[model samples]
Target: MSLLTRLLERNLRNSGAGARRLYSNHAEEESSATKHEFADEEPVQPPRHQKMATDQDWSAVWPGPRTFQPSVVPLPLRQGYTEKGAPPPSKFANAELMKIPNFLHLTPPAIRQQCEALKKFCTPWPKGLETLENCEKRFPIEIKSTDYCHALPTIRNPEARRVTLNIKLSDLKFDAHAKDKFLRLVGDRYNPNTGILTIVADRCPLRKQNYDYAMYLLTACYHESFVTESWESSKSEADMEYYSFERNKSKQSAEAIINWGQPVEEAKKLNADHGFAQSVEQLINEGENVYNLGKYKEEVLKLLNISK
Candidate 1:
């Protein structure tokens, strides 16, 4: 447009070109200086694991439980969270592998060696207590307990305090009155068929204290059962909760029906019929089960001489 404006535009283009040519030498010098600084430095080499010899003892290498060491372990282990379709990372200093404990010391050979070393500290088994029958005969009372372990803040478990004491009812010698009182005191803890009396104690906070409490209860029950009160002596057959026909009027009535018009002494002398009556009494006392009732009917017919 104007002569001055045209001249300024041409000079600006020439100045840019001249500036590039002038800085070319400076840029090369700076680049050369950077190259010289790093030229003597070599590329870093990765850490290498020492190759183990074939005859090396593994027990000495890994003596106890410890974090997994990829450098020490001979196997090529791989661990780490991988994205879908991607392979897991190799086990060289892997965090996932190091976090968990290793059971390298628990090899079969190591375990056998440990057992042999500890054998001197162990006591030999009692000679005569090999059989279960002999063990039961010697130790009549059986004590049962439980233990629990958890990875929690507190190590104590409430259930570990409970203790159970079991003894046979037959082992506790008692008269009829004492036995009845003892059974009443124990309530449902007594298993009549198995004749086992189980006593449980858990009030105390410790296992040993609870065990001692259970033994004390058993001792108290036994001593209290033998001490007959005035009211206990006055208890009659009518007051009995469970029926025993032999000790009741039912046995006499059945005997009279089978031996009518015979002398009381002669009826008592009838051993065959008397045994049948006793069997029938037992069946009745045990409740009217179908098989037992049938057996009872057969015994009754035989006693009465009733033919088909």
Candidate 2:
């Protein structure tokens, strides 16, 4: 071989060896970098509930209202419906559990603690208003309203705006004419059995407004009841709401039969038969029911001194 060709071959061999060495070093560096990256990475942690102690204060952990967290709660709660054979969905990553309200903070012990804390701000009951009867006497008017909490965009409930006012008719001082007029004005709103006049007001949008409206209605009815119209005086016995024996022709007939051929003073005394008057009034007013009719028959026989 020529000297120049030999020299070129030797140089090519040296370059090939250097290239192999550089490639080996680069591969070793890449492998070491990959190993270091893996060593620096953190391991995945277990759930928070697994780390929590069994006797831990749950109220402190879940203080106040919040969306449910599966990892934070210790209980194995499950929700959401599944197929007939399948079990309900687990608490982990459950949309059903997260969507609804959680009462975790309102545990019995927590409630007792809260109530104790609030006791200092409360006032003792008034001395005379201990009994329900005394309370009703002291506060004749009873106002009722409702409050609601919902997971809705708007907190205002339409039904909550309605206000109800209840008061016994007897609580108000009313004469015969005024009482009758008040009953007529209230119609069926006044329960005869309970004697409770219920005034429900929902015409206004706000609760306060509805409450004011109900009070206004009650006051208006009360004042209007005492006002005697000219037409009311003209109401004859036949036009009376209830039968009154004294105001009916039956009174005169009974007096005539009882005091036949007697003097005026004797007739007046004989006319004062309370049993006969009561029987007549009841039979007419109560629509002649079997019991009332029997009572009337007995009273009539007694009044006329006739045997059954």
Candidate 3:
């Protein structure tokens, strides 16, 4: 080979050798640095749960709500579905367990501790409100509402805004006219079987606003029921909703029949019997039922002294 060609080949070989040695040195330095860095650190200990005693205070460890962590909880809890008859996935690295809310903080001991801490803020029960009947009598109005908690962006629930007010119709002080008007105004809202009037208000956005709206509706209905319209005075016996013995012609007919063969003083003394009036009213109002007919016959016989 020529001298220039030989020299060029030697220089190429030297450069290639130098590049290979530089790469090898870099790789060895990196490996040694990594080993030294790790060796300076202590070895990772086992999970905290492995060292925990059986009687450790769980409340102190998990004081409030949190996501499930397998390393923290010592229990051998398992979750998730598997095919081929395989057992459920263990708690370690479990996505299913972490997705759900954990009640680990609400252990019996934790609940007792919380209750004991809150005991100083509570008051004793009132003396007279022992029985449910007594409570109802003292506080007739009952208000109902609901609260919700879930994993959501917003804490407020739309259904929680609804407020319900329940009160017995009998609890209100109503005269005959006011009671009739109240029943007519409330319609199906008032239950005849239980005498409970339920008012549900949900138009407002907040619970307190809805509660106030319900109370306003009740107050308006009550006051409106007591108002006497001018046209109500013109309601004649023919326009009456139910049969009334005192307001009907049956009262006059019975009185005339009872006073037929008696003197003025004796006729005055023989007013229509209260029982006879009630029976006649029931017989007419309840139609020709067998019970009503039987009661009417008994009352008539008693009134005329024919059973003697």
Candidate 4:
């Protein structure tokens, strides 16, 4: 708007115009130089191709899904058990046992309670049972019994003795039990009559019911040891036709030897019941030693004991 200001402004514009024109010319020169350089260079042969002479290595190829190994691995085989304690058969007895007739075995004692009748029948052999007369110890016979009840007082004669049974013989289930009872009773040497039959018949081991007649009959069979008359028969004396006295005596001896081994009187002792015998021998030796040492004048008479 003022004259001097206009004159200063015109001089600034004219000076700035030369600077701007110079910068513009410099930019143009740089672009031209790049263009000329590009034009002078030959275009690159599109890139040299390489034909790979070796196989492509895929050793490092990674698996798509990651997996983990089991902590408890699978096994081709596993472990278990065997039957170790099976029993061996050889040690046991499988023998076919001798069986008795059912009538003889299973019958209630009422049927077999005939000790008196059997004694009556066996009466023909006063020396002993006729059938068993020629044989070893006669097995006491029990026959088909009748239900006759009677009282027999206990006998204490030396030849005849009486003992009570733990269980009644007639009440046994069968001949096996009867035989066991008989053997045990007869086995005693202290006495022959250690068997007793009871009307009490209780304590019968097999069925436990009492057989009064059976008990009495077994008692009578046990009585056979003493009452010779109970077994002695007028008939037996008459029937000497079947057996002779000399023959009977020989038979008795043979039977005794066969059944009881020359009587218990002939059995050898295991050794006289030495009892305190060894203790006395030891005391004597000990006393002798003390005397040899001259320790006492009396010579230890404790074993010899002289004073009254």
Once fitted onto the true fold, the runs of candidate 1 whose alpha carbons sit more than 4 angstroms away are 1-111, 257-268, 271-292, 305-308
lDDT of 3 by residue, 85-151 (tens): 8988999989989987778999999999999999999999999999999999999999999998765
lDDT of 4 at 12: 97
Q: Predict model 1's lDDT versus the native.
A: 0.82
| Candidates' RMSD to native | 10.5, 4.3, 6.5, 39.8
Error of 2 at 179 (Å): 0.9
Tens digits of lDDT, candidate 2, 1-308: 69999999999999999999999999999999999999999999999999999787777888798999999999999988899999889999899889877788899878888899999999997799879999999899999999987767686999999999999999999988899889999999999999899999999999999999999999999999999989988988778899878777888888788888887784355763888888888887778789999998999899888997
- For model 1, how does the per-residue alpha-carbon lDDT over 1-308 read when each residue is reduced to its tens digit? 69999999999999998999889978999999999989978997543345677667777788787777777877778877889999889888698777665677898877888899999999999999999999998889999999876545576899999999999998888997789889999999999889999999999999999999999999999999999787866788778666665577766777667667777685364434565756665676677788788887788788778985
Cα lDDT, all candidates: 0.82, 0.90, 0.90, 0.39
Best-first order by TM-score: 2, 3, 1, 4
What's the TM-score of each model vs. the native? Answer: 0.62, 0.77, 0.74, 0.15
Model 4 clash pairs are 160-226, 163-196
Model 1 / residue 299 / CA error / Å: 3.1
Q: Which of candidates 1 and 3 reaches a greater TM-score? A: 3
Alpha carbon lDDT of residue 105, candidate 3?
97
